[model samples]
Target: MWVPVGSMFSFIEVLPLVLLILDAMEHHSLIRKQQRFR
Candidate 1:
């Protein structure tokens, strides 16, 4: 019971890290596209 709850919290904590990495990747791709167009 407690173990499952702790795992849930760990997943929640990792969610933001995943989102941050995705956001950075998207920004990097956009910058690359703009550079290519120029």
Candidate 2:
């Protein structure tokens, strides 16, 4: 019972990690494009 609860909590924790990774990737690509334009 406790294991299932803990897993759910961790799943919530991972949402922000995934979002941060995606945001960083998008920012990196945008920066590269800007550099190329310059």
Model 1 spans with C-alpha error above 4 angstroms: none
Q: How many residue pairs clash in each candidate?
A: 0, 0
Residues 1-38 of candidate 1: C-alpha lDDT, one tens digit per residue? 89999999999999999999999999999999999999
In Å, residue 20's CA in model 1 sits off its true spot by: 0.4
Q: After superposition, how far is residue 3 of candidate 1 from its true place, in Å?
A: 0.7
Candidate 2's displacement at residue 27, Å, is 0.3
Q: What would you estimate as the lDDT of candidate 2?
A: 0.99
RMSD of 2: 1.2
* TM-scores, all models, native as reference: 0.93, 0.77
lDDT of 1 at 22: 100
lDDT for each candidate structure: 0.99, 0.99
